[model samples]
Target: MSKVRWKPGNLIYPLPAALVSCRSKTHGDNLITIAWTGTICTNPPMCYISIRPDRYSYDIINESKEFVINLTTTQMARGTDWCGVKSGRDYDKFKECGFTKGEAEVVDVPLVNESPLAIECKVVEIKELGSHHMFIANVVSATVDDKYLDDTGAFNLNQSDLICYSHREYRKLGQKIGHFGYAVKKLKKKPRRKKIN
Candidate 1:
């Protein structure tokens, strides 16, 4: 096999396409679709979202120091793409997207009711990195839709038909081959019965 080299850039594909909602005393409520977001830590439950300074929600989040990260689904593909392309400065995203504003428990910001899961975050720090500024936040609370829970009360997120962003396209999740620890898990062999003469 041969390898081709290219200039250094953000080549990572298949990232979670999140809808980040924010509200300010002056700007009201707004939603911004973000692909550059991910969990940063486990213990304290930290996450980060990078947004351009010119984005409408950037100033709202910066001033409020809070936002809700709503996980997107295949059903929300159009709205997700639309929100990213259009600015909240001119449009009321929640109303235009037909999404109800659900009240968050820990923060004053509203979440997208259509979302299966909403992660409420409070900004802890900000880092200016060229084109986009990063908002490092701590997860204050997370709300999951009860409809996705099984009889055993386990959250089946895969059943939600979640969508992801890859390259310049939005794609749905594929088949699940295995779960965590399945690679090293032992398989049990059935006992053979002795033949009777």
Candidate 2:
């Protein structure tokens, strides 16, 4: 089969559509639905979200240096889309979208109580990349819904109906095909039965 060539672009789709909440010490809170966000580091537990400087939430984040990344789910698709299209400058997103504004564990930003998981982050660095500025933040604390926890008290995020963004549409995550390193890692097994003959 032949394929048509296209210009180079950031066409990477199927990304998590997170609702990033931020608040200033003076102003009220706001939520910005961000699709340009992802995990950036491990040791420091960092992540990054790219935002246009003109966006209303940009100033709040720039001044506060902290925000809460609320993981959205299929149930929150309507609110997620609303948060992205509407301007926080005029609308109270939390109230208008019917989402609860809960207190954050580590940052001044408010977290969405309805979200299954919320990660509080503090900005560590900022890089101006043309049209958008990437804010690299370190995860200060993570709060997960108790209902999603397993019997062992471990958080099971996979069980949540997580939503992702692809080509301007929201998509729910699907089944897991494999675990980390399952493709090439040697599997542990019961010691080979020793022949006693």
Candidate 3:
């Protein structure tokens, strides 16, 4: 196969379409659907979300310095798209999207009740980039929906219909590709049965 070169751009596809919730003294509570979000570090538990400077939630986040990243599912596709398009400056996204504001354990910001998981973050620093400003944050708290927690206390995120964003469309997370370290890890060998035969 041959490869074609295109113009320079950030072409990383399949990003989590997280619902970022925040609150400010003046703005109250709001939601902003963000695809430009991901985990940055794991040791101290860090993550980030990038937003345009002109976005309505940008100032609110600046004032609050905290936000909740609510993981979205295929069931939440409609609300996710709507929140991304509408502005907090004009509409109350939570109310419009019919999303319940769940209380976060650590952060002042509220989380999406319908989300299977919520990552509460506190702003550590803000890097002003060209079109978008990145909010580098330390993960303060993470709450998973009780429904996703099994009897054994294992979180079955695979059972939840999680989704991702690619290009301009939201897509469901299909079949399990592989587990972490599956490449180098040893595979179990099947037991031999000969005496019984």
Please report the candidate that would top TM-score against the real structure.
1
Could you arrange the candidates by lDDT from highest to lowest? 1, 3, 2
Q: By the TM-score metric, which is better: model 1 or model 2?
A: 1
Task: Mark the regions of model 3 whose C-alpha exceeds 4 Å error after superposition.
Answer: 194-197
lDDT of 3 at 172: 94
Question: Which of candidates 1 and 2 reaches a greater lDDT?
Answer: 1
Per-residue accuracy of model 1 over 25-95 as CA lDDT, tens digit each: 99999999999999999999999999999888999999999999999999998999999999999999988
- lDDT digits (tens) for residues 1-197 of candidate 2: 99999999889998989999999976679999999999989998999999999999999999999999999998999999999999988999999999998898789888899899999999999999999999999999999999999889999998889999999789989999999989999878889889998
All candidates' lDDT scores? 0.95, 0.93, 0.94
**Per-model TM-score versus the true fold:** 0.97, 0.92, 0.95
Q: What is candidate 3's local distance difference test score?
A: 0.94
Instruction: State, as a TM-score between 0 and 1, how close model 2 is to the true structure.
Output: 0.92
Candidate number achieving the greatest lDDT relative to the actual structure: 1
Candidate 3, which ten residues in sequence have the lowest lDDT sum? 188-197
